[model samples]
Target chain A: MTAKTHSLERMIFFSDAVIAIMLTLLAVELPVPEVPDPLHLWGALAAHGSEYIAFLISFCVIAATWTAHHMLFVHVSRTDPQLITLNLLALLGYVLIPWASKTLGKVPNGAGVIVYATAMTFLGATMLLVLRHVVRSGLLDPTAPRGVISGIQAWSAMTTIMFALSIPAGFVLGRWTM
Target chain B: MTAKTHSLERMIFFSDAVIAIMLTLLAVELPVPEVPDPLHLWGALAAHGSEYIAFLISFCVIAATWTAHHMLFVHVSRTDPQLITLNLLALLGYVLIPWASKTLGKVPNGAGVIVYATAMTFLGATMLLVLRHVVRSGLLDPTAPRGVISGIQAWSAMTTIMFALSIPAGFVLGRWTM
Candidate 1:
């Protein structure tokens, strides 16, 4: 019942709720097929392959981000309002993923892909920023290894670079399939 | 960290991710509004009033359930495998919300509303079960007040009763608007 544990618990509880809802939301892109001919059902679904692809990609992104978030929190010992706010901002990046994917799913346009990639990049960057904050602000357990933070740094960097590159690559390809 | 803290943390983290994803997924029912006449966009958006209503109801249900979950967890002082499994099963209730909402959104039938209401009832009841188990098994903090537990019991009972009643009422009314 210490003040700090209560604050941390609130953040953890809220973060878990947000992540759970966002992860499951990916299936919203899928529709129940209603083809008259059972044989045509596969083809009918295949026709909306972009939507499926968007869902898959977004699902992986959210799952990976959740993984990273959980890993980071294990080392997080204390959370201030600022840290909670940063976490909230990072969750906002996750909230926008569905919007970005829906746009991509609907249009499959260069603009849509750019927006999607940009959103992904933002999530990666925000995670990186949080990790940096946790490490720099002494919010982590003293026993927490430097290696854990370094590993996340590397992973976050890769996510940022790959996603950021997809912007121009999406435009050059003329179709935002990326 | 105590083994209990780790177990609780894992459950909280996973549950949060699931809730977060499901809550945001509600918006998927809304279309991007592709009216050729820009003037008709508002009308187009307003046309799907039922879908919006379904979204709002489900959103509140999930948010309220999350609040309840958070409140109850504040008194939870220990954890075991059974508790974690029970928690996961309750989370399954959340996982199914999107599917029920999607059905209700697509068909808007007595069947769909019944399905949605049934899911909500399951969540409420499972939460009640968890609360009762925690109280019975002496899993709560020693300092926790008896009044807090009784208050949650009252709220949980109300949720369970209202959602459960919607089933027969859905058939009587030929629609489950609430």
Candidate 2:
């Protein structure tokens, strides 16, 4: 492998590590329902339904983000310092996801919803920046299909816009905005 | 990429995710020392010295494990089902490292020490098994260096032995065994 390929691989590995840690962090603090008796187990678990839902939602979001990252990197043949910086910035937002999920689970209020939405929006926006950097810098493989490249960029842009819009919806819809 | 390379890539990505998650989980439950005033902060932090040490040790161990895995996989060009299974088993042991670290930090007893040591030994042994599988099953690239392969196996075996020996020392030395 060329030095460029090796550097790119390291970047991808580091990003994957951060993404994985954030994904699993969603469950690290999930409360295990305590019950007085065996019969109360189901009832106690049912009471923490919101926490479970929060976990599920964050898990899906992180997984989808990882999928997008994996697909984009498949077309990428090299990396630049700017792209690496943007990737790190994107990871900074990802690392906040679990904290946002926890706040939403505990409060389920307008503020909590806003926090979660903002984190998601930041993550998507940073990722979009990375995609744009990759495209503008000609870092992708020479043979990469035009349709695939545009498709990824379009999807990233749309996701970022949706999350950005959700911030305001959090004020009007409360927890329902999630 | 051929189907085989794609499958191997997926396996490597999944392993990287699990390793990253486990590494970050080491810090997830770390206690932030509470103090009544700013002046008492250093003293309060110093009180949890063992916890800090445990965290540092586990972090290094996990990071070293990841480095070894990366080095080994650089020679491996494909994966088999048994190799995948062994990798998962290795991850199961790795996922226990954070819990073991927590126990050692909290209790600092023989049992806790033994738990931590055993987990480390299991991880090393399983990774050694992966190396052996790769070599025996011809999963490595044809151009892979023989010296590099044996060096990894030798290091893994030595580390596993050291951890196994520590289990007995934990009985006699208590927390100092760490």
Tell me, by DockQ, which candidate is best: 1
Assess the local accuracy of residue A173 in candidate 1 as a C-alpha lDDT between 0 and 100.
54
Put down candidate 1 lDDT per residue, A21-127, tens digits, no spaces: 66667675576666879889889888888888888988887887788778878878887656766776676677667766876676554655666788799988888
DockQ (Cα-based) for each candidate? 0.14, 0.08
lDDT of 2 at A170: 64
Q: Which residue pairs clash within candidate 2?
A: none
Q: How do the residues A43-111 of candidate 2 rate in per-residue lDDT, one tens digit apiece?
A: 999899888888999998888778878888999998766776687577657766776687667655455
- Top candidate, metric lDDT: 2
TM-scores for all predictions = 0.58, 0.58
Deviating ranges (above 4 Å) for candidate 2: A1-7, A23-178, B175-178
Question: Over the stretch B30-52, how does candidate 2's per-residue lDDT look in tens digits?
Answer: 56454433334347558887887
Worst 10 residues of 2 chain A by lDDT: A169-178
Deviation of model 2 at B9, angstroms: 0.9
